[model samples]
Target: MPEGTPELSAKDLRTLIPEYEGLALATTLLNPEPGEPGVRESSLGGPLLWPADEPWPYCAQEDHWTFGSDLRNTTEIVAGTVPTVPILQLFARDVPGLEFPEGKDLLQVVWCALNHEHDPGPVMPLLYWRNEAEVVAGGLLSEIPVAGEGEYDEDHMPEPSTLSPTPTDDYPSRHDLPEDVRDTWEPRFRSPTSGGVMWPSDSNVIATKAGGWPAWIQPADWPDCDGGHRMEHLLTITGDIQLGDCGGVYFFHCRRCPGLPWDWRFDCH
Candidate 1:
């Protein structure tokens, strides 16, 4: 638990609903606030400690556009690929519980900020795991390419913010609950004032989180890797950035597979 975060223990909830006893999962809530964070620090939408020698990533998807009535910034459409923007940078030191690949201590998330109507996910995000020491040893990329004005979907472009990683226990949303468990608890989750059934979906923190279950707005859609192993939730991006109609982007990885193959899904309210 981090300081000043109101104590909302899932363990206590479990005492009232024993069905949740075996469903609690350990997770870290990334409480992000607008600020300037160093490249090497754990941050949301902050500068990355990228190797200077390595080529920066760009979105070559042909559908990339910058002009549209629906877009936040409706400037003239730009031609060719748009540079992928930084969304997150995490240091193992800041989040010790995070499982980094062997010899890797840093995790960076960058993505194409433009919309992808044809694709399932709104933003085509990418993940990178790196060694902090090796990046510094090689030399850091001083100038990272960014999407020029009107080149990105403003709703998806997050402002740089520092992170306060707070450890906590998270239980699955009612949708992810076992059929029997949901059936037992659903009827009891009524609101006294409204006299309407008020499901505690937000009990699972709907923020940028690591591990635990996803704060799903709809039915849970867990993806599987080529190895046939069910993927584990790696990270959930929300709150700090406005996705499609207050949606969330989820990242998942399969630890059982070599190289930890990953996938993503997007859901909106």
Candidate 2:
């Protein structure tokens, strides 16, 4: 490193994350009750058994639902489904002038939001702008924005750090079903109806709940934000990993998923 040697711009960092075709992700909002348990409601002068295991009411909006009772006592359950583009809509509408930059990609934005990195120093640029010119290095790439580069430099090339070939099961795997998956959900705020979770609950804590069955389920081919989603079970995919880097993501699922016994694939994308 030298005094005038330019540093990697935010645009440069953005190039690291290669978005595969399926590199997309969404937030699961509700885990509505599936199959017949004890809830048998047929409503309006009829029975009350949930007419063939329908999803919970407002389950589609589970992302913003306020909790009332426990799963056993309540008649329905819900979570959120945060599709990327729609999720962006939510962020844009809430932000003043939608003036947020350096955090755009859903997973990265969600991670920053979750980790409380409101004042992004390094990651802001990478995730915020896809195009290089719009980045913080906008016009200052070689103008020297920092002075610490020379401080860490050495007279000659330093030897590469080495690790022992001996391996251990220190973090052999990443399997844990996390409950503390925190999220920021507002009250009854309405907008252009972005696709997410909404239900009646005390907190807008965003995370996944038991999907009823241990296997998998998909409610309908074309799911709407309604009763249809609740009936669907938790569709899962698993694998293993060292780190999950997106626009800038840090899914704690590595610790939260193992406990639940997911296949845990090494490569999610």
Candidate 3:
């Protein structure tokens, strides 16, 4: 509904699976210049409004998918900017009609320092914050200080020369789409090439219908809910959120359970 090609119409999809429910699709392409407005309520390619009291998040796990000498480079890039790494926050509350667990609000945070690295190493760094207030106060209401110069760790600072070249092709179109794909969708739907919804129309299967980019629906990676049922596909933050070639950030949640804490995962292809 946010303006993109849908893989299947609700009527057509229901014909295939009568029990199919709908999904809300949102897509955003970020601008990477310094000093620009980086934070927005439900968009990607923006800065995160992190509390000044919180330390900048670092990949502490030694076995992280993208760990090694490149870690330093990634760290440096994140810290290179005057105001820490750009963070994108997706809140379930802001997503109209999203049926999240009761008494809890879900927020998925993603940050990647190296958007253009040939190999972004491992999965991009991610954080999940679950606010348990009935009214969902604080972070949403309070005016907090954002991370700025001298706030981040100095040791991880990057040298001016090592930063990845500024991304010139902010949003590249998919020229390699197969004839079948090209024929099935319109030009506007096929181009822009990245970020869109892959709604779940077949039981637990998520079908890619919007942008040519596909959403990865990995049940094994889905976080379990207290209701004893697997989480459902909420939506995906697709496009170049700096995770490397055509990476997508997927979000899942349990409709029956309340505040199971962690419910999101990231993957790229």
Candidate 4:
């Protein structure tokens, strides 16, 4: 719902709320630079085609749960230097009426490792990829093993960097809404800041932090599967471009649920 966008009227939301149940909340405005036409953008550590023989994803949580312990004095494993700003990327097959799962394609990447010292308690480092080319040619020749390695300090490993796509006019807008959410759904949806709104549940007005973006409070249920059904609303993932607050990272799926390890779900706020 990106170009022009403005169609929400189930009789003007049943006249503001006569038990309205048409469910209206939509937004999809992401342009991760580099030829933006249909999601193929990058940022968090910019530059990816990775597979130089895999093995670059480290957390090894001990107490380094969410960017604590001086996060290796701001990454590159101790600031040996290499990250030129990049902390979020969203691509669920370029989003635009997402359905996915049938050749599989999805990617949500995020990374932030610059703390200097205090107030750096929101360490960002999230990755989820499920591109299929025969499951990446059978897991790109295996080499996975590095979790908690004797408790940190190998220079505090945390590699996997390269992302490019920096173009911004600060997209996502509904003109700074928040006057009680434009007095409750602004006469029937269209202002969760324009490019952000999807409510099947998880109430939402945005407020959830931890590497930010992910809020789906209240019985948003429908993310546990056994192939019963119900779980579809793919696309939200907004922290805009990362720094701190401004939540939203909701994604769900269940194309008909079969393989792909129980469809998808990346709830946030």
Candidate 5:
């Protein structure tokens, strides 16, 4: 390795990682605020910049996930031996969808920041948090309790004395913001927009294609409310991933996958 070597581009990652061929190029049309600068549409998110010392609990019997390199590196980094950089914002709100509303992603994030911690899929906001980057900036998203009643006190902080367990007669639906709390959560995550090629890669995602035909997965065991179909999730690719024979756990980070571009010269000179 050279001293001035640059970081690996998403294209380069495809080659370094095996089993890359099993991926489908699913595009997430991010509904960031209009005219927002630096937010690139059709952009691919990948190569999750994890911490050397992961704050997550022990999964199975294995040690926690190492942020950057090896244990020595993670320790050095944590003990102020290695430099610490501000964690970047790598996660999007929703699991990429067609016309997926703006505040929806934030709603999911807020929900994660507020209530649900681990595997928040089937329970809260109907979303998943596997590869989504923990919102590190606002300290909103932290390692959710791997077990039990969660650990954060922000969302759980007791409200005003009057805000008790007793519920009012009713509440509002569509929120108009400063207008009223009732209408606030009304229009957020409306039933996922149906019709058209919404989720081409989702196993449970059901949508009518260009030919007025439904497409998605259907099985007897699939869970549902009204017996509807369910789409599968984009999975993380984990195996004996080795970076120069020193194995590094590999996860499927979607960088628009250029069909698993084999190793490139990199030097654009």
Candidate 6:
């Protein structure tokens, strides 16, 4: 368990509700605090260790725009492409338990810092698994494109922060519990110390974490990969960044297939 975090034992959970047995999953809580981080370090909204030769990703979606109206008529908006900004950079050394593709030790996530109408997430979020040594050997991209002031949505652009990853056991949220378990447990095993709050409410951690079930605000919508295999939750972006209406962005990947296909979803308060 992470220090200073509330204790929630799986054994106690199972004793109260047997159906919860073996439901605990390994997860890493990425506690982010605002700071400047080096390119090689694990961080949120930090500079990426990107290869110099690789073309940077840009969102071509013409519908994206900031919440403010003044900058909406700019030439860049008229051109219809916006540069994607780094949202997260995770190193294997910080999250050793996280599964990585063969020879890959880093995970970098980028998304257009603009809002897309009628979409669940950022205009186009991109994930990359890379070898740290290979990126270093090939030379790093010294110049990265930054979204000009007023061109980016401040809500989606997280301030650069360093990460302190803490590995712990995570359990499903109340929403993810089976109907039978909810029915049987809620009535018979209410916690005396919790006031009126239920056990699951105290147990689940809702923050930027890797692995485990999503901190879903609504019903869970676990997506399947192209190969039909259920994807596993890879990351959750919340608590540290303010998405639309204080929502969370979730990332998932399928390990059963090659290339590790991934997807994302957004949920708000």
Using lDDT, give the best candidate's number: 6
RMSD of each: 5.2, 28.0, 12.2, 16.6, 22.6, 4.8
Query: Which regions in candidate 4 have their CA more than 4 angstroms from the true location?
Result: 1-52, 55-77, 80-98, 101-103, 106-130, 136-138, 145-202, 205-269
What's model 5's lDDT at 177? 15
Q: What TM-score does candidate 4 reach? A: 0.30
lDDT of 5: 0.21
Off by over 4 Å in 5: 1-55, 62-90, 93-230, 236-269
Better of 3 and 6 by lDDT: 6
lDDT of each: 0.80, 0.19, 0.38, 0.37, 0.21, 0.81
lDDT per residue as tens, model 6, 116-185? 6667456588999999999999999888888887668788888999999999878888778877877786
Native-vs-model 3 lDDT?
Answer: 0.38
Provide the clash count, candidate 3: 7
- lDDT (Cα, tens digit) per residue for candidate 2, span 1-269: 22333333323322432221112222232222222222112111111111122221211233221113352332222333211110010122221222223443111111111111232211111111122223323332232111122111111111111111111111000011122211221222122245332321211112221111111121112122222221222222111101122111121121123222211111112
lDDT score of residue 241 within candidate 3: 31
Q: Which stretches of candidate 6 lie over 4 Å from their true place?
A: 1-15, 69-76, 186-199
User: On lDDT, who's better, 2 or 6?
Assistant: 6
Question: Which 10 consecutive residues of model 6 have the lowest summed lDDT?
Answer: 1-10
Please give the lDDT score at residue 88 for candidate 6: 95
- In model 6, the Cα lDDT at residue 244 comes to 64
Output the lDDT of residue 121, model 3.
28
> Could you tell me every candidate's TM-score relative to the true structure?
0.87, 0.14, 0.43, 0.30, 0.19, 0.87
Runs in model 2 lying further than 4 Å from the true structure:
1-130, 133-138, 145-172, 175-269
Q: Write the per-residue lDDT of candidate 5 for residues 1-269, one digit (tens) a residue.
A: 22333333334323442322223234322222222122211111111223334543212211211222343442111111111111112233323332222332321111111222232211111112323233333233233332222222122221111100111111111110123322432243122443121111222112111111122122112122222333222221111111121111111212233221111000000
lDDT by residue (61-114, candidate 3, tens digit) is 332222235556433333233233434444454443444454445444544333
Collision count of model 4? 16
Lowest lDDT sum, 10 consecutive residues, model 2, at 165-174
RMSD of 5: 22.6
